[model samples]
Target chain A: SQQGEEDPQALSIQEGENATMNCSYKTSINNLQWYRQNSGRGLVHLILIRSNEREKHSGRLRVTLDTSKKSSSLLITASRAADTASYFCATEGETSGSRLTFGEGTQLTVNP
Target chain B: EPEVTQTPSHQVTQMGQEVILRCVPISNHLYFYWYRQILGQKVEFLVSFYNNEISEKSEIFDDQFSVERPDGSNFTLKIRSTKLEDSAMYFCASNRLARGYEQYFGPGTRLTVT
Candidate 1:
């Protein structure tokens, strides 16, 4: 299926704390991307990490990819109430063309 | 700064009826795609279009589904017959290249089939 599976289906944290979410996929991928969706709104792209890259960072977001384990993790440092949203991990398979197989996503709630 | 845009933010249709969802991608982007997310489910890809033709499509994009780029600016997805299960949030996305880059997504159209 090449579907990405995310763990910790939901997480709640206080502002100024850190929250982490993990995802595991079944097949080889070209790249993995993280996206955030606020309630029923559109998805906002967060970060992209290639298979060859082990880690990357953007602002308060940090992403790590381990091809050997076919797993990835996203960490949001110093979380804010505004950061409350559903975080999804999507993977572009090596042979899947432009299609992105997404995980079920982790619902995050950051309390102020 | 260009982003994807979709029309009819919300649509309600009866089962067996046809519906067409519209989208206008980023001006310079060449690759366009349609994806959907059922309530509380994962986002699933339906089709990918490039150069005005379908380059790739998932099994979910069955005979009931069709895509077209009738004009230079608009891309459309038509469902021959809506099923109750077809109700979902449909998102349109686009990218400048075919791969390796993030695809910009639209606000999405919520289709409610009754």
Candidate 2:
């Protein structure tokens, strides 16, 4: 696994179902952020959680960080067809000077 | 909402040719960065610029690559001589804070080298 690696590289689910993606990293980070990317498009910022923060939420997205476990999870509840996109978790190292190391990303498909 | 904008959505250039991918980050953002995705691969960082200078860069950003904020609004990445493997989607991103903040990315410039 790389610095940031997301599990379940691909996921498919019903429109009203929930989607959960997990990410793990090896190094200590100052903050972790999730991004959504439609195929061949730009990245959309989802949420950011600092190392000291355990959880954060925005709209239908919930992000949890467990630094002790070096892992994070993004849960999209009551997902809709428009929620279909690739989700990536990126880490900013404590001393990396704004460099964001991104995970391979989980390809999510919400079938309506 | 303010968003990052990039130019020439698609650029096709021959190997060894010079190509500059342009970007206009959010007006209020202070930090700028360049990243690239080689097709199905993960997005990789290229460089981060702040205060009109490069703050950090990745190993992949070699001598052939250079970044410049020629003016107040535009940030550009110039690949002096393109390589076959240089074919990838280049994304420009910006953020208001140096850390603990989300970065906004542009639609990306797909550079196809032949």
Candidate 3:
């Protein structure tokens, strides 16, 4: 399987604290994407970092990619209670098209 | 502000019964995909469809599994003779082009196979 794995499978933090999730994959990738899923809801696209890019940010979410290590990280800064969700990292393999292999995901809980 | 939409948010069926999960992807996107999560596990890719045919699929998408566009706006995943292990959340997703970056997903359909 080309799927990657995520670390810190579950996390808990107080509101306003920062939450960071890490993902590691085995193969060379064209791009990596981050997604957030609220309980029992659809996944919302968070960010996408191409292989050539090292870092990207959107609103309170920051994503970093290091191709040499085959790893990526997502940082949610100043997280609110509503930020609680399961975050996954999906990789688009160098040769694959249209299908993305997803990580197990990090379950984040922000307590108010 | 368009998002993917799925019908029959939850389904309960007996083993050996066939069930079809329906999805309406974002209007302009051309590539469509189906993924399933066996509760507590990683989301696994089932299949990808484009230009009225399958572009790619994973091992999990066996002979019992099939996908179709059927029309301009709807994409569907059909499970034939579902087994107990088939119980999972099925998610429908789409992106603008191949390589499938930045996909938009529909609220998954929870399938309970009894």
Candidate 4:
């Protein structure tokens, strides 16, 4: 299994607070992506960080990657109720192709 | 913005029956993939198709499973013999040829095998 493992399987935060989720994988990867899924819906791509890059940002989402540690973290700043969703970290294997291996995911809940 | 679309958001079938899940990937995209989530489990990759051939597949994509792009617009996953354990939410995804890293997923088909 090339899948990653996300820490803090679940998280809850106030609307104005920040929420952080971490993922650790065992294999080398070309790129890591973060996705959000609202209840029963398809995943929405949030951000992508390449192995050559350490960090990337999109809107209020901040993603940091540490290839040496084989770990990545996603931070949602000033989270809103709408930010409550299941977050997954997917990795593109170093070999080739667009296939992705996904983590167990972190279920986040932001209270308004 | 274009996105992948799946048909029959929900399908119910009995064990031993065959099921076909359909998807229409974003037009102009060159790569297509199938993934499934068994309720609370992690998303598992099934297979990937490119250039009209299977580019890659996981162990889960065994003899019971097969994929085809029968037409120019539709991609399909066929389960030869559905089992109760086959119940899952199947997602279809596509990525542009120029950007293979970012994939767009369809809403998914909730397959219920009883």
lDDT of each: 0.94, 0.95, 0.92, 0.92
Candidate 3 residue B74 Cα shift, in angstroms, is 0.8
For residues A29-74, what per-residue lDDT tens digits would candidate 4 score against the true structure? 9899999999888999998899999999899999999999999999
| Clashing residue pairs in candidate 3 (N, C-alpha, C atoms within 3 angstroms) | none
TM-scores for all candidates: the values are 0.98, 0.98, 0.97, 0.97
Worst 10-residue stretch by lDDT in candidate 1 chain B?
A: B95-104
Model 1, range A48-104, lDDT digits (tens) per residue? Answer: 899999999999999999999999999999999999999999999999897899999
lDDT of 2 by residue, A1-112 (tens): 3777998999999989999999999999999999999999999999999999999999999999999999999999999999999999999998777889999999999999
A-chain TM-score in candidate 1?
A: 0.98
- Cα lDDT of model 3 by residue, B28-79, tens digit: 9999999999988888889999899998998899999999888889999999
The DockQ leader among the candidates is 2
Show pairs that collide, candidate 2.
none
Question: Which ranges of candidate 2 are over 4 A from the true structure?
Answer: none
Which consecutive 10 residues in model 3 chain A have the weakest lDDT in total? A1-10
Query: Can you rank all candidates by DockQ, best first?
Result: 2, 1, 3, 4
Name the lDDT value of residue A20 in candidate 4. 98
- Inter-residue clash pairs, candidate 1: none
Model 1 DockQ class? high
RMSD of 2: 0.9
C-alpha DockQ for predicted model 2: 0.88
lDDT accuracy of residue A51 in candidate 4? 91
